[model samples]
Target: MKTAIKICGISTLEALDAAIEARADFIGLVFFPPSPRHVDGHAASALAMRAADRIGRVGLFVDADDALIAEGIKAGRLEALQLHGEETPARVAQVKERFQLPVWKAVSVATSEDVTRAESYRDAADLILFDAKTPKDAALPGGMGLSFDWSLLDGWKGRPGWGLAGGLRVDNVAEAIVRTAAPLVDTSSGVESAPGVKDAGLISQFCRVARAA
Candidate 1:
């Protein structure tokens, strides 16, 4: 099967266009205020309109409230919700129930134990995103360009569905795909010229490499 690609932290129309041109499966719009890639409701609406049935839009959120999630869903016309914070299984289910959208719970992987922990969300989330863990004091949960050991996922058979993220670039995404056999791959800082700045050339190249793998 072909590995799906998601270009995340897309805040500008240029970045959104790049993802669409690259034929990426999804583009992430961050709603967390602390992240450099965070976009307001109006900005997200414009970007969503520009995307308009061409590609899927996933909204990234921290431990946000229902009101904020509602605003993001309305603004971005999100197809899915990616939870990237310390949310419990119940909360995940609650969000999924409230939004009535496919919910993806991002599990921070630092060890095999962390990988096993993803099972808690198997029933609650529509997908489990395995991402590298960040420091407890760090301002951002992901998009730091930090990767965990891919070997930890060797022969991993956890359900409902899953994907790989963190530190994936054009040069290394092929290796990541081979190692994990992930059905989907996501990247943010790896395809950026600077923090929160998505590079169009890099986006295209990353998609090409990931598909070729």
Candidate 2:
């Protein structure tokens, strides 16, 4: 099977089109207010419309409330919701039931124990995203370009749908796939020339390498 690639934190038409033209499996739109990648509801809706279902459009949210999600849903036709906060299994189930959409729980993996915890989300979430844990003092939860030990995924299997994230770039993405056999790989800051600024060339190269891998 072909490895799925997600070019995340897209905030511009050029970046969105770049990911689409590069055959990205998913395009992420961040909704968090604190991050530089954050996009408002109106902009998100416009971007999502631009995608036009050619690629999956995922909405990234921190610990958001129902009102905020409702606004985002109204603005952006999100195909999936990525919970990137300290949401519990019950919360995941609640969001899935409430929105009747696929929910992806972002698990911060630092050790084998972190990987083990993903099992609890097997039944709750549609997809499990394994990301590197951020510092407690850090303002943002992810997109710091920090990576964990890919070898930690060896001999570990949890839910049916899963993806790899955190510090993934074109140069090392192939090695990551080879080591973990990850079906899906997500990158935010990897293809960016600056924070929230995506480089089309890098996006194309990342997609090429991931597909070839």
Q: In terms of lDDT, which candidate is strongest?
A: 1
| Overall local distance difference test of candidate 1 | 0.95
Q: Per-residue CA lDDT of candidate 1, range 32-138, in tens?
A: 99999999999999999999999999999999999999999999999999999999999999999998999999999999999899988989999999999998888
TM-score to native of every candidate shown: 0.99, 0.98
lDDT of 2: 0.92
Instruction: Candidate 1: give the clashing pairs.
Output: none
Each model's lDDT: 0.95, 0.92
lDDT of 2 by residue, 1-213 (tens): 788999989998899999999999999989999999999987998898898979998889999998888787777788899999999999999999999889999999899899988888999999999999998899999999999998877756746599999999999999999888898999999999999999999999999999999
Off by over 4 Å in 2: none
What lDDT does candidate 2 reach at residue 184?
Answer: 93
